[model samples]
Target: MKKVILLSMVTLAMISCNKETQAVEKVKTAYIDTSKLLEENNEAKDIEEKYKVKSEEMGRELRAEASRFQNEAASFQQNAMAKGQAWAQAKGAELQKREQELGMKQQAMLQTLQQESGKEMDSLVKRIKDYVKDYGKKNGYDYIYGTGDAATVLYAKEAYDITTTISKELNDKYKGSEKKEEAPKEEAKK
Candidate 1:
């Protein structure tokens, strides 16, 4: 009787463990390309495009100022050399201070834009996470991972890539939004 009871318990335990392992194997694992997602994400893309256009305009204005300064620099250099070494030393230090101030201002503006862009990127990441939630629910993914930053995942199996599918779906969704926005404008123009 003791031998039979022991055999029964071991059999039950083995059966339960086997079922648990099979359940685990049925789960789908997925890896996401986060860089591609952020780059092609609609909200992030829009912010990036706006930043590019604005920054280009700012750069042109800065370049024009640079040309003006370069022309004036020749005069400053000539005048300073004619004066004593002390005068040149003082002028050079003043010019350097002004340049440093301008550099700091540029740095501030860049930091502001970056902060704004990063916020938008954060929003996009949230959207992707929400999408992944819905996707996991619908398609039965066990684990979906973002592999862009701070990830230990070096390489995932080829079957585990969810980038292209997500990109296509998100791109289509963005196009749908564009159509909705443009519809009223077209009607007004017509």
Candidate 2:
């Protein structure tokens, strides 16, 4: 009977301890400030702008290339038609085939360059993720969240928003660093 009583006490203690552990576990909520993150990682914005510019340039280049190729192809068409009468028709077919092979190589190179830009974008995204994780941990955030197109942050408990605190720290540190760097310049002007 005493052993049974002792076993019950031990079971109760274990249950209480588990309850205590659950109670102590920190409740975490997190949200992403995409604008803030984009601002923080200026590289992302730069990449986007540069991507737009390069894409426009590529478009222009392709347009010009297409025109040039069209003119050449037209010339070949005439030559082939004439050569068909002047020589073996098989030779004209061979020339047109060669042009197609060259066109494919050009297309492949453009695709590769486009893929390279995507890689740069992916790298920037990874850096932003690292920054957010660091910011969350440093600021005692138990949970972090991502803000998407339809913001679900409509009404979060005020306590969940550690963003202002994190933002202030980031801004203040940046300003401080800038001030330090500019101090010597101002002193020189004086």
TM-scores of the candidates are 0.76, 0.55
Top candidate on lDDT is 1
Task: Compare the candidates by TM-score and give the number of the best one.
Answer: 1
Candidate 1 colliding pairs: none
- Residue 179, candidate 1: how far off, in angstroms? 1.6
Q: Please write out the lDDT profile of model 1 over residues 1-190, one tens digit for every residue.
A: 9999999999999999999999889988898887877777776778789888877787777677666666666767999868989988887887777677667767777787788878877787788789878987788888888777657578889689888888888878888988999999999999
Candidate 1 segments whose C-alpha is farther than 4 A from its true place: 1-6, 26-28, 39-43, 81-97, 152-156
Model 2: pairs clashing at backbone N, Cα or C within 3 Å: 30-144, 30-145, 31-145, 32-145
User: Candidate 1, after superposition: displacement of residue 173 in Å?
Assistant: 0.6
Tens digit of per-residue lDDT, candidate 2, span 1-190: 9999999999999999999888677666767665565565445566778877877776786677667766866776767666766554565565667668668856875787679788997886676567678887877877687554546565666566555555555556556866898999999999
lDDT of 1 at 122: 78
| RMSD in Å for all candidates | 3.3, 7.1
